[model samples]
Target: MLDINNALEDKLLGFIGAGNMAEAMIRGIIRNQVVQPDQIIASDISVERKEHLSSAFDIRIATDNHSLIDQSSVIFLAVKPQAVPAVLKDISANTGAEKLLISIAAGVPVKTLAAGLPKGPRIVRTMPNTPATVMEGAMAIASDSPARPEDLETVETLFRPIGRTVRIEEKLIDAVTGLSGSGPAYVFMILEALADGGVKMGLPRDVAETLAAQTLMGSAKLFLETRTNPGQLKCMVTSPGGTTISGIHELEKGGLRASLMNAVEAATIRSIELGKA
Candidate 1:
């Protein structure tokens, strides 16, 4: 667990949708003792999902969204982005000022969420990457004015066990979505390319993949542990006229850095467009 302190205290945690991300959070929170299984409640439209969550985690299941909102102190708006409006409309009357809502729906702005609910609803918006399922995610959190400092801290506690969390302005959320939210796919593609390179050098397919993945993992670990500038680390690896420099030359020729920057920029623009929609 990245954060060991239990922040839920006596507050009951609820999930409006019991999907993969919600299940991952449930698994992580239970595994880390962030909250007792009984301290949680989740509701899903699917009966099979409700049964699976109950049997898998031994937590109480809400009969519907309204019941979940009525029972839970802190609620996670974990439904699909397109379903958020309907869910909000259904629960608006039941959700009062006392309740704090944290949303994980991508590209849904805090203003949009607030517009769907009653006046001055306490809301926090967050973007967490797919790696959260494995407890290795990077997440960014932003809160509206109605959300107190304690609310933000409580939100942090719920997410910390699942991965690392950072506080950011809501305006920067599109950039975060472009970067970390979509980052794993980019990394996976790089890994595949690296494995292909190794295969081109006559290595077995499995061995190539293993070596490529380990290299990427170790490089990331080294950078994080040392906190060294990546360029300095790259320079350290590239002795003059060496094999690494030779590879670097090819990467530069292929415009790798520019391509990655363009990818992030494009994604960010698309996120902004989606938010407007």
Candidate 2:
């Protein structure tokens, strides 16, 4: 908690693109009371979406990027990667030393953003997952050369209320994009598999789904809170020839661990390729 109240005083938090991720961050900020809803502003190409944002969150909305930029000190680059170049160009003239530019676009490198202008704003790039919608996101942040320590702190303060934030080198962002960025889908698949197993074992579909989700959530929370080694936790559940051990044996035989590693590696390589393009 880096005193966001004082740090964000008189500064309007703005989003350049109003999409799901932008809405999530806005909800998190308002839910946590980091700043009042009135202090937030967002711009979108669609007037309907902007109106929805204003009506849903009680925040200000601008119809164009420049109008939003003129009113904001901390700006979230929430547009798609394909749209970044043009959007950055559109806003570059107005961006400067005083504004903190944070991008959540996937696979767009910090260098690309810095080169958006001859002298860029203090830029910070981030890879944030969809769990941010629930205020439980895992976000990895990296900064360009022009970004100072305070700039990173500004990003942390902005995101801390939403979920966990970590500082990492720019080079690792693609890998992060592979892991946490794409990881929720992997977990969703696992959750589906678990629910299917429960269904096959005679549980109703809805009950199985709840059990599958809650079990994973509880297990993750317990591991994080206790800082317990996963292997040890597995052993704790496994008795000599117990049902848990039998299930574990089946999972190991099915090569679950290797499959997950391969999935992450494949996704990471794809992310790198996207960055290169």
Candidate 3:
């Protein structure tokens, strides 16, 4: 394992794209003081966005991607998949083997990144969810052959402050994308339905929303803290011939469980297809 202490103190961190996801990571780093605000650098095509980042985080902004790479030791390739090739081509010549490159772009494989950068640049690929905005995300990371154990540790430490992280093989990244990457939307839909049900039961809008959200949050906490299978937990909550059982029967009749399973399968397959494209 990479020492968490060493990673947290990295002096120079660069973000190649300053979009929403990158912004969230930057914000989390700043909020946690993982590194000083002055230690960070970001780049984007839009002057306005760059200015926003500079002002918000008190970090340097590169008008172009190469300048960002030039100033930092650790680089985050936060650009869209379509933009990765061009950006990498522009910076490959300048990047040395010592720099650690972490990419958040979906479906862009390690081989693709290695082909784009100079030979032997340490590379780490990660899948992070939208909930990263609140520092409650679930992230998964995989490293290329050249990446050292220290490099993997560094990447994990950087993400740990933001949320939970798991290390897995590069091949499993698509499944991580399907589960955590797209899972938040499914949870949101469930919360909305729960709120609607509350409203139908004559609760006020705000009350219904709070109740629904708290229910979800509490259930999540129970599963995490107790480390119990969800089925076991659900059984514990469900008394014989009770309201919970009645609601579960309604959900089963609606094929909710099967639908969710199919949803995850579809997402996993689509993620693979997107990578191929």
* lDDT value, residue 271 of candidate 3: 77
lDDT of 2: 0.86
TM-score of 2: 0.94
- What are the per-residue Cα lDDT tens digits for candidate 3 across 1-277? 4554465355469899888888888888788777778888898887888899999889988767777777787889998878888888888987878778898887778888888885567888999887776788899997543688888788877898888998888999888887888899999999999999999999998999999999999999999999999999999989999999999999999999999988888888887877666
Q: Between the candidate structures 2 and 3, which one is better when assessed by TM-score?
A: 2
Encode model 2's per-residue lDDT on 1-277: one tens digit a residue: 5776565568788898888889988988899887899999999887887998999999999768988888888889998777888788888888887788888988888788888855568888898887887889999997543587887887888788788888888888888888998999999999999999999999999999999999999999999899999999989999997889899989999999999999888888887787667
Q: What is the C-alpha local distance difference test score of each model?
A: 0.85, 0.86, 0.84
Q: How far is candidate 2 from the true structure (C-alpha RMSD, Å)?
A: 1.6
In model 2, the worst 10-residue window by lDDT is 1-10
Arrange candidates, best lDDT first.
Answer: 2, 1, 3
TM-score of 3: 0.93
- lDDT per residue for candidate 1 within 1-277, as digits (tens), equals 3232343445578999999878877888788777789998999998898899999999889999989888887889988787888899889997877788898877889888888887455889998877777777899998543588888888888778788898988989889989998888999999999999999999999999999999998998899899999999999999998899999999999999999999898888888887777
